[model samples]
Target: MKLILKACIILIILSNTAIAQRLYNTSEKLWKPQKDEAFLQEIATTIPTNEPVVSVAETNETCFALMSGNIYALKSGKLNKDNSAPAGVTELKNKNGDIWALTDNGIFRFQNDRWKKIDDKKYVDLCMHAGKLHAATSEEIYRLEGDRFVTTKPENGYYSSNMTMLMEDGTQLHDDPVRLGPISKIESYSGTLYVLRPGKLVLFDGLIVNEDFIDWGLLPSKNTRDMLSFGRRLFISTDRGMGVLQGAALKTIKGEEGLPVENTTCLERGFDQDIWIGTERGAVRMLKDEWHYFGADMWLPDNKVNDIAVGNNVVYIATEGGLGVINFEPFTLQKKADFFERHLEEWGHKRLGFIHTVYQKDGEWVREISDNDGGHTAPYLAAMCYKYAVTGDPEARKEAVESFNAMLFLEKVSPIDGFFARSIWSTTGDKDEMGRHGSGGLPAKWYKTADGKWYWKGDTSSDEVTAHFYSVSLFHDLVAKGKEKEMAKQHLEKIAAYIIDCGYTLHDMDGKPTRWGRWDPEYLLRPYGYVDRGVNGLEALTFMQTAYNLTNNKKFDDSYNQLIKWGYAANTIRQKNVFPPENLAPWDDNLAFESYYTLLRYEENPALRSTYLRSLERTWEVKRMEHISWFNFAYGAITGNDCDLEQSIKHLREWHLEPIEYNFRNSHRDDLFVEPGYTSYEGGLKAISPREKNITRGSRNAVALDGGQNGRRIMEPTGFIRDYWMARYHGFLEAPETNDPELTSVKRRTEQQFGAEPYKGLEKPVFY
Candidate 1:
């Protein structure tokens, strides 16, 4: 029934197709302080195994621990191996309540409480499928036909022991017995059979041996010990850490993601659907909620784990020390209070309680509060606004108050009316290195204030404006009460009133609008200001709405309506009409999210809501990869359109866990289609071609980290504290799933904040 051929096709060596591995200097100093305490503190104890454990298996009644070359049965918390127990056992199995062992000497079956020798010949593995016994050796697969083991033949073509890796150009590399080692592992999934050889995966559908294959070298260590599938992803364990394969992409998770080392030994899927890994150093369990690590001296004895098996609530680990068992639960707290408190106090605080970006100088982490201080700090302030507005957590309220007061210092210290400085620094006579980004200072966009003792950045962009207004609006409506609330209202009025009084343009002391701070009729109506008009006009409208919302000022409404009547609303919509492959740039999306937040505040107006919702949807679709949690949660709160709750959480996790700036390259992959030309100004724009690049990204993206700092590293990541609480506030991602009592569902996770929405009677803490 099987067809045999002497030789066949050419080997195709595909280039540029490689798996992703990222490196981060976490122990060193960087832009932010990501202690990963939540990721760290969850570690359970590591048990010591006195013997060298090489393999492990769990049967219904007993657990088998293979150490050195002896098969030991773990019972009553004690390990006992028979003196005649098969030595050099490669793997142990409890098949359907039947104890079986695969050793180099022979295949043995245990029955009636004792080992019964079944076959004297050697075998690699033993498995039963469709009520038939099957065994695999290095070069051949055997099936039981009645009493005799027979070689199972392929239906259409003979699976020859000899195989060739054919190149695309008709060249075949013939190394039959050299590099093409025996089948190490095999598994059947759906209707396809996957066989793992020494350096390649041969997949068959029982009929044809497909030409498609994966490069084994693509693995982090390529010393792949074993593999299994959970959900839609394949879990691969190698000499290095762990890996997950979904579709065409392979993501290698290493030490940066809480992994202690890269030398991984074994892997198994937990009863609770978690991924359990065994390594030379310690054992790791990737729970749905968090990554759990077990260190040798920390709790583990011997430190080297050879095999892992999970039963119900306990993890049975086979280690060189003997055996280690761990009991772990998922970290399921909805609020990350510790992360917020620690990080905000450590890296976010600037001079006089203001917010500033933090980075490392030498070995110490320092908050660079004076560099684009307004832009970096605003995201944090907004996050706190959502926190206080929703939960009324006193800590959030206190931080918000501190941030608000610091922002006020920006205006008070400036001699120019209503002009807020980018940041403040101790008045040194030399040029403040705050604005000196890469090459030089921010191109004359800075000036010393009236006092020689202070300096503030000039030519401020609209990014700072929206951040200040947005945070102030949230504080006014949510946290600040009475006089403090009135202060926020006063601040909003002065900023809005200044813009309106100056013909809808933010004018500097030079009596000229900043380069990107113009929305007056002269700029919006002029042809030269086309690019600025669409975005600026949109921003100014939102700014007015925030002012009106906070102060209930009629003039803010009048100013907002005047722009609508002037056709800037329609113009704004047209200007932001990005579709398909053409997406919103990063800065533009930032502006759009800020615009969405402020515009959606006065949702009582149906017509205005309709106008902005369309633009928001387009922006959300295009910028989905950005995974702005606050933006995503805000949208989910207002519209309930899933901006990908799970991936949104993954994005936040990546920020919290690995905040390094690893370079991502799109030039190589064959699976992704490339969009040619002119989308972005710098570097290159590579979109997911065949289909437009939307938001189907996981923690790993199309971008691959090539070991170095690819671009600017960020200190203040935007999501986490704000968006997470917002999702909870909006009643989107609340209540744990009954099936999985732990871990937030990334895919279905959902959110809110700002304004007094009658509080919904949610619990609140005293802010005093």
Candidate 2:
């Protein structure tokens, strides 16, 4: 069952920028430190691209940089391979002349300048013969016999490897059969011998064996660190840079050409023909093709280089803070958007107005603005009340009047009547952190009032009265005007007249029933709030028909005609066709998409618009795989239906969403399939987080990706700014042309006053 076909991507990845270049003007300083490049120091812990250098015969008397068994040297009034060697004096490499070393206890030369053992037994490689010196050791092969190298063997296993040849003589043997170990170099050139192999370096010439002149692109087959050729061009180097192959073209020089350090271990050519290189973070000369770099802010004592021998006049570096030398200079620049606006003020903590979620802990990142602030800051206060009703911006109406006065101080710090607090810390905090932040295990509450001065978080559930009457009816229909719409219609009329004066529920201060904040009519006629009897009687008849359309009152219209004459709106269309999101759970699909937007705010009557169009055609046939742009704009704004507006603008162009509180986890996806249990009207409540990084954009049966709930943080998606300003204040959408804060909030405006052309096919085109 491998389906995954999803197509429709589209992403200009944001760069239209012009609503007066908005990053919210001025006071800009969001952290940006990458402070300029260039410099070196830090000699060891690594640098062994199988020896980026180890010399004696290419003489300057004593040059070394092998690392991983450390050894670095070079100094003579620091002579002139472009001078600079600070942590020098590690020792042994002809400290002042005569150097020759191989050791396992054998071949050690260097006369009048010290070192002497000359060759007695052990050896793994240091051979030249036909011209005097010899030694092999994989199990014997020596031929110096006078100053003594002794024993030998080449009889059956025709030996001699540096990349495989066993040709009886031509000399060489430290094998490589695809790097089965030992074989970092063998060179010879002209008459051809070159073996180097780990990422392709073969050659042979004695009757053809070329290796098609080696290619290996962004260099990396086995750290082919140093290869150089000169003139006919070969270069190679690589810890990811300097490949240059020439002729059939194979270019690569990296660190974006300025070569400050991408790892390159060693490469030498310099004497004015310039090439030098060798780095961890220091020394890169290139010349004529220009690239200087040098690091550790110039004058190395570290910066992990490991080998760079130049000779004719000093140049040695092998660092992990040990032997680095430098005649350096490079460092000056900074502004990767000021390092991404100081990496977004490195994660919040706005204390006293509650922000929390800047998480990291014990090693720091912290934000915990006291966790679960009302089932997640009511979709970030309805995304700052649809960003203060489509940018009438006075800083989005002072962040929607400070998240609507901290959600009207959660029903006025509830001293018992309207109950609401799911967050507020500091009675010196943790006063039982909402008893371990319940998802469905739903317990742990704290009260502590008077003289305690602060600390009030009772279990007023029903997802904070469905995000406080849907973000106070989006701040009383788009950013409150007249005395903030009579102070948000007098706090939604004292939180729905204290839940219709306690008869509907929410009664903490131990007046009982705060658990699951029950709905009225004696808890929906019988089974006492039976799994919250269908979205608690459709969120108490849409909060008393939105407090009887803002106090035309008649006892909030006779408590919405006494919950539609006691049948409680036909038990919310028969407990919404038996809550089938394959049997109910993720907060009963967030109380059936927050009781299907108050049955479309009373779908213009006509018998409650045919039972709210038969409960949104059975909740949009099981919530269209949750590309839930607020249930495709409230079922195309209450039943002109035909949803899937290109999978809700492909979830409003996904765009890496991370505005903080991460932890999304798609149950480690593999496409799909995994039914699992549920249905007892969903009371079992187990599924802790899977449905697309944890649903709750007012959850329409959290479509697939397995029932949710598991440390489900998911902070700011602001449900793509609450389904693009409620699909552009319900015209169903298409008005964007580009003012650019994310393409002027996804510009797209045509549909005329509302749902015209019955939303035919929804335009399409978008592939990323």
Candidate 3:
């Protein structure tokens, strides 16, 4: 016992130490140019090396390239690698028609037929901000005055230091105290200057530094990998994922949600507000509301994307492998509207209703389908299809019918004896292994018990019989629609009888009867009400209602009342947030479980209707507006909250647009660019904090924008309009009020923050 205790203590200490080290250690090695000026004359005589290009600029129809410590000018589309200028250029920018290049030696102006060096004593990072060329160094910030560089302070206040460390490893690399820390890169957006340090991001508004200008912690990542300003948001690549700075808050885009890569290398905004990300792994493009990946398999020659630039409607990428280019026509609002219309026409009208059919075999009842993948059940698809069919579009109706038929095929089960078997292959008589039978067969039936009970099956635990009951309820709803009504009724009767036979009420076979079920025998039942079991109870009640409505049977009402009592007791357990380990079912402990299932059961219980509505609101308040695939009990929660069954679905909508954190590490810089596969930013946001308001506007900066009218207008302006609307459709936010003053303020702030001014010369482009 003493040795075991010592080992546990040592493990805890090691874990804590590891966490602390990870939090504080953000250092990285700085890249040093090999043999200063070696590429200057060498490139002038020999072929250009494969060292990736850093910066590219075009002025007076001449294209100049900055690569591997040397500068080259392209004449007649041919790079002058042989006789290029002998300057180690660091930064390049074009103002009006003239090109300015900042190099290690000094600043130079390219015009007419000369490379005129702008002699200056001090040098640092350079950028064109508010139509002026500004240079920022460790000691001070300087702007061009007449033909010379002059010192200038920001509008608020200015702080200059002789000694500072700015680079990832400046403390060990540079020896000059006068050199203003390590300024890796500099960029100007709207009228503000942004500085990127090792692990920090700061903004200078021509005055004092706004310490709160951007807080990455709100959208935390492992490291500040890379950054880019596009449209109305600032995109930042971090060790874990990518972050977008909208207003004062940073919203993260994780790699787990379909990002091509996580280790972002560079970012650029294109002609149509299209944002391009170049990462260590590949390249990704965000246009309007869609994301596309380009790599070795998709036009890109390599995966190591270093930098990106836009020229003549084409995007250029520099990678370790080679240079690649992609030419894509910009998406338009008309196309977006048409697409949305088509989407709605095909799948908009289906009203999700309560399930009516439940199948019982031997002594256990079962559902018809599972909720493991994307929560697409046959009944759900049918309801969605039916809703879309009501739009008076024949094609939509046809598609809806086809989808409904497909669901029928997916949920069909063979009947046997007075009761039906759980599935075609599995018999309900094998209860011990089958555990809780649902209308749908087990995703994997290999683990079935001899008594017909499904054991700890694939991925999910065995104790979660509520999912099965919910499935039964969903199946029953399909029956009422005149599609297999007889089968649905028969299955419902069998399930009711099975429930009664199982100790007169629903209870886990392995444990004592409580308000909820358990996941497995070894696992203790959670004292918190089981969401899965509540869903089952709700399904039973819905079945009873259907029976009563069909036959006017008092027994159905009695059974429903009993189930409602059970539901109320279970809800009491959940409100306390205390669950005895012994009572926990596989799906019972999740906090969002009960409310999500309750949303579906609202149609059955009119007596306790208000209680269910309140529970939905409370769940929304607690979950915020995030979507967790595991917490799918609320698949229809949004519909319930939106319609008469509940009061407000605002929380559902809020969570749909909330951003979330996926990856949180810096093991490899390449991971910064990897795209998160098929995940929603809003879904992630809700998963983090539930109490966060969906809509908030303050000053010129806001983190999460409510989908108000202003938000919709700016959505297009910022290239996120499609996502904003989709979020609404997915019950992530309330329908936006485009005319609200709060939304107008958001638009103004977005413009001011991004420094986007309407340009007559540029073609009108679609917003995201």
Candidate 4:
């Protein structure tokens, strides 16, 4: 049988080469946190209003909003007109289990869906203090006494000749008499009624107002917008930043303290132990020591926040355009993986086992026939490889095999032996709207297959080759078995042998080296390829090392030694280029890391290993600031050293749930610190979290100050899936301490919801 002959050939090759295979320990369950665990996922839903909403108040039953001189109640994510609400209402509040509305005619309370006049006098603000309703007019404050308003006078003895304006450090400033301008707002905190007047703060202790207590010197700005009392601290939102008053000590939370924007608009206490601060451009939640920002457009219909109200686990923000509701539900990284995995099928991103990103065409999702289909799908294939190795899930192996075959098909469908296509198009499908031009405007060579059924693109770049070896090597070591294992070995062997045969260049039918596919010493030693010599050399050696390790072929081992003899090893000493500022690109990092992982993993020669390790260390040091998750994970897995795992985990957690590529501009943020000019390259010294901006991949610049697709494309989540699963497999992360069952079932629920519609277009051949 063919199996017997293949076994004999492999034995002969192993005996001849005598190369010991060093493989990853896939069965080893080193630690947890490698698997996905349940956590809370924040979902933003925008509720549009007919008119600009002014204020919001939450009751035990529902939330009520005042809009255009009418009141509306929020129920089931909709606003219904409350006809019973009194006309000319200006403000609404929940006081003593009743809905109180401040109207032009008078003050009214709603009980059993009927409005009743509570007071005939209009008040500027109302608050509950010491189990009594307190109302404020322009000049005086009143308290309710048996359904009647009574004035509260200032205490006679507490008055002083001069008001002291002392700084937080107890520095005294000259002051004038106790002059309260007019009571504009009143709030209760720590058993004292603090009334807000223009530039003055008067305190009332049950009996009378203590007019001498005025907040002035410590405030960041005189024009304050909102005030809130949360957890022994009084927060005042102003145009500059938030001023915190904690037991006479004053501090500020501006750009330095992680406030996304300085000009705050409103503030409210959260349903839990947190505070919500609304800004001119977004909303921020301060929980303990962390800040979560929900930016405009992505999280709200408008940027100007008018008010905020908390209802259970949801926070309703009243923006200028409408109400922005944020709901918190349990979710986990594993659940996210499940969602993306299903998304590939439901969104029709997978075609013939090749994954493509989606873009809207005529209001429907259409697959983008991209040039780097092989390169893009590499992470997904590797993810399935790690997923199968970690969980021993048969489904993971099934998906992995299918994608691997698709990668193999790239070479199989090509005209030249060992040459692979960047992507393929079926003549049976609709015409290729993507056109035949590479990213750099080079003429793309699309050759018809002998069967006249498929058109395979030629002139493959180093990008595709690097991704191919990286992914297939992982499949061979982790997922392949029996015949599939042999197939993986042969696939790598042919590709490695072809480069050697063509003098270290991928030659097309014209017998010329394709652009960016040359790795020969003649090309590398030339001035044109001087900057590329490092990464290209590393990539060349990786192919030989991977092939020899997997196939035990002496030719690959011989070729590997020849490349080392040509000073390629020394070229890799500083593999990452930093000299020419323009050459400093993130895509090189992706290519180098992929090559370094394979070469270092399988190269047993101590000298080469040492040289590659040095290169990896230097490269990771430069990349650590970006907190690029894949690079961090690859470094940790290969080096077994601290790779800033915590920051990488934070980066992963901050990946936006909505994967749409929306434009983001962060150049105006005050917290940015650009690095030295030699290395800055329009990148911040510290990388911004993904939640604050657009989704990024390893090939794309993660630290770029500003850029996006403006919602024209949807980035595939395969990169995230790959990094997370790799972390899981390599023990960089551990299993979560607790897992919520409800959160864990999110994948199942999502599949049921969106898995119904069949994918459009002609069904291509299934690689599996």
lDDT of each: 0.57, 0.50, 0.41, 0.76
lDDT of 4 by residue, 1-768 (tens): 999977866664443222112343223322233444455567778787657778887777578887887888888888988997788888777667777888766888777767889888888777788899888776667888976889775542223323354456843333433433377677787777776665445665643346545443466776777777676877878888888866556577788777777889888888779899888877888888767777766777777788888878888888888888888776667666676676666656677777777776666556677888899889899999887776666688889998998898888888677998988887766333545697479988888878877777888889999999999988987878788888888888888899999999998878899988899988998999988899999999899889998888899989989999998988998878876667786788999999987887787767777899898988888777777789988887676677777777877777767667766766666556532322443344547667777666568566675776766677787888898777767767665555565554343334442311333444444433
lDDT digits (tens) for residues 1-768 of candidate 1? 123221211111111011000011113221121122122113234334565666777766467788777787776677787666666777776554566788777877766777766776777765555566667777556776754678664432333323455456843444432221267765554334556675455554443344355533365765777767566776677776566666655677775555545677777777676888777766666777555455443334556777777665667777777677665434333424334444444332334555544444444444453545666666666667666545445677787787777667666667755777777665532222555541124355556756556666766667778777767776675567677887777776887888888787778768887766788878777887765666777788888887887678899889888989887776666555343333434455566666776667664576777777776765555445434455565566556565566644544443322232333222322222123321322223332210111111111122221222332332343435555555544444543334342342222211221111111111211222
Best TM-score among the predictions, by candidate number: 4
lDDT of 3: 0.41
Measured on C-alpha atoms, candidate 4 has an lDDT of 0.76
Give the lowest summed-lDDT range of ten residues in model 1. 15-24
Candidate 3 per-residue lDDT, tens place, 292-383, comes to 55544223445676666666566666666545655443222222323323322222111111121122335333222232211223223333
- What candidate 1 gets wrong by more than 4 Å, as runs, is 1-329, 333-337, 346-351, 362-364, 427-432, 437-444, 449-452, 552-555, 577-583, 603-606, 621-628, 640-656, 662-714, 735-768
Query: Model 4, residue 42: what's the lDDT?
Result: 73
- TM-score versus the correct structure, for each prediction: 0.56, 0.25, 0.43, 0.87
For all predictions, the C-alpha RMSD in Å is 17.6, 25.4, 21.5, 6.6
Error of 2 at 67 (Å): 8.3
Instruction: Rank candidates by lDDT, best first.
Output: 4, 1, 2, 3
* Candidate 2 lDDT tens digits, 1-768: 133322211111111112212311223322221112221211111122333233322255455443333333434523122122212212223212334455555556656544457655545444343444434453334556566666433333333233455346765444532221243443344434444555656554333345556544434435776676666566667666667665545577664554545567766666557777766656666777545444332234454565565545345555555454433211111111112112222333233444344444444344443435655566656655654454354665676676677766766666654566776645543312344554356656776656565665676677777777777776776667777788777777777888778887777776787667778666667774565666678878888887777767788888888888887777676555443444455555555665566546533577876785676666555554444567666665555445666546434442222333223322322222212322223322222221123323454333332332222232334445555555544444534433333312222343332111121111211211
lDDT of 2 at 8: 14
Q: On lDDT, who's better, 2 or 4?
A: 4
